[model samples]
Target: DARVTQTPRHKVTEMGQEVTMRCQPILGHNTVFWYRQTMMQGLELLAYFRNRAPLDDSGMPKDRFSAEMPDATLATLKIQPSEPRDSAVYFCASASTTQGGFSPLHFGNGTRLTVT
Candidate 1:
């Protein structure tokens, strides 16, 4: 069975500080996704990749956030000079391509980033 793990379930940082969140995907899954949820934005798809190939990242705030998959089981998201508005829950998900982009995704508990 595959299980995902996220680091620093809660993080409080000063504004303008750099924050890094990490995710460990389930074994054998090739697709990874990053999502952000806020009170105003609700649930938004920040970025998604398949087989480490970026499929789409249009929903991400290109100016401050970046997402990448270093390997099959590892994914990372970094924010530089993070602002107060950037405080939110960041979740990472992984899925297998059983039928070409039609597999169920397993999500981590998420990293709760609070910029102060």
Candidate 2:
């Protein structure tokens, strides 16, 4: 079965440290998305890519956060000088388009981050 896989299921870091999250999208899927979930923000789409190319990332903080797809199957999100406020569960999801419509996104288990 197709599935999105994420690594380092949990992370804890001090303020100002660097944090990186990785994802392996389902094979043959052309779209990938990153989301951040928090009590205040609910679930926010931070970025999304189609055909392994970034389409938008306006919801992400450009100064310290970045999202990228290094290849067809791998995606990454990074935060530098991480702050306590950045702590949240980050999710990676992937989808494919069919003649009928777009397939529903398959989400990864998410990486829970904690900043001290």
Candidate 3:
């Protein structure tokens, strides 16, 4: 299927537990991104990628969250010792860079994480 896919659509975990979310972008898209959505902040960027190499992850908290693209299709977001405040809908998006510029983003439904 030509669609972005996310695993464990709903996750509930205890405080301080480690949580991992996985994504598979639409095949052949070269760029991927991770973003988190909260009621107050809306959508916040939390990842980085350009041709399979991390470009900028400054939007995410360096201490707890990590975003990585191990290969072209797979991207992962992880929270080590997750906290209650970390709850949110995490989305994965992919796009192709055009010579003309500005390709549309295809996003997965998101992994909803709730830490108690």
Candidate 4:
């Protein structure tokens, strides 16, 4: 009955500050996803990995955001010199699927981040 867990459910920081968000994906799940939700992007997929191998992160801002997996149950997202436009809800998800890459993702409550 493992579940995805996220830290710092809410954060407010001035522009140009650093923000670190963390997530713990479900145990035994082989796929993980990072997504950002906003009115503009509309739940853009940021990054995904299976079996600790990165799949894609082209949707994320290459300059400020970075996502990584330190272990099977751990994932992290960091934003350096964040801007006001970067404000959004960041979610982490994991799934246990036999199929290749079409498994539905199970998302955490998400880290609600707001940059001033």
Candidate 5:
């Protein structure tokens, strides 16, 4: 399978732990979307590609989590000192948004993170 999502699909970490998740889109799919699913907020777009360059994750808590695309195929999300409230399933989707709106080709199976 493509690196749309990372494995182990379920992750468990204690509070104040550091968690890192990585994803790689299929070839030619330049855009990536990072979303978090929660009971209260449902699907939340934490970050995504912008202007065909590196993502600007200003919408998220910069100090808590950081997102970036080092190359065309690889993307990474890191959470430092993760809190229990950060528990949720994170999905990474790849699409060709450069040409049009979101048209995802592959989506990550989603990583269920449980912080306690």
Candidate 6:
């Protein structure tokens, strides 16, 4: 089955700590997405990349969070000086695109992060 793989399924950190999450997207997919889920925000798209290139990341805090694709299969998200408000589940998803649109995305189980 085609699936996204993520590392460090859970993390607990004190405020001001740094947190890093990694993902491996399904092979042959050209689109990668990062999302954050919280009680207040529900599900918000943090970043979007096409063909391993970042398309948008305005939903995330620029000074604290960053997302990147080192290659086609790997995607990484990092948060520096993490805050209590950053406690949430982060998800990585992969999808194929057609005619500039997108196909159905396959999502990873998610990484649960807690910042105290």
What's the distance in Å from true for residue 14, model 6? 1.1
Alpha-carbon lDDT of model 3: 0.90
Estimate the Cα RMSD of every predicted model relative to the unseen true structure: 1.2, 1.3, 1.2, 1.3, 2.2, 0.8
Error of 3 at 43 (Å): 0.8
Candidate 1 lands at a TM-score of 0.93
Native-to-model Cα distance after best TM-score fit, residue 64 in candidate 4, in Å: 1.1
Model 3's TM-score against the true structure = 0.95
Worst 10 residues of 5 by lDDT: 50-59
Off by over 4 Å in 2: 99-101
For residues 54-89, could you state the per-residue lDDT of candidate 3 as single tens digits?
888999888998888888878999999899999999
TM-score of each: 0.93, 0.95, 0.95, 0.92, 0.85, 0.97
Among these predictions, the greatest lDDT belongs to 6
Q: Model 4, 1-116: lDDT tens per residue?
A: 56799998999999999999999988888889999999886888999888878889898888998888988878889999899998999999999767555456788999999999
User: On a 0 to 100 scale, what is the lDDT of residue 29 in model 6?
Assistant: 95
Q: What is the C-alpha lDDT of each candidate?
A: 0.90, 0.94, 0.90, 0.89, 0.80, 0.95
RMSD of 4: 1.3
Where does model 6 exceed 4 Å of error? none
Model 3, residue 28: distance off in Å is 0.7
lDDT of 5 by residue, 1-116 (tens): 54565655888999999998888776778788888999899988888884346565665787899888888777888899899989999988888764556665578888899999
Compare candidates 1 and 2 on TM-score and give the better one. 2
Mark the 10 consecutive residues where model 6 has the least summed lDDT.
97-106
Residue range 26-108, candidate 6, lDDT tens digits: 99999999999988979999999999889999999999999999999899999998999999999999999988688999999
* lDDT of each residue in 11-87, candidate 2, tens digit only: 99999999999999999999999999998989899999999888999999999999989899899999998999999
lDDT (10s digit) by residue, model 1, range 1-116: 55789998999999999999999998888889999988898878999989998999998789998989888778999999899999999999998888645478899999999999
Instruction: Give candidate 3 misplaced runs (Cα > 4 Å).
Output: none
The list of candidate 4 runs beyond 4 A from truth reads: none
Winning model by TM-score: 6
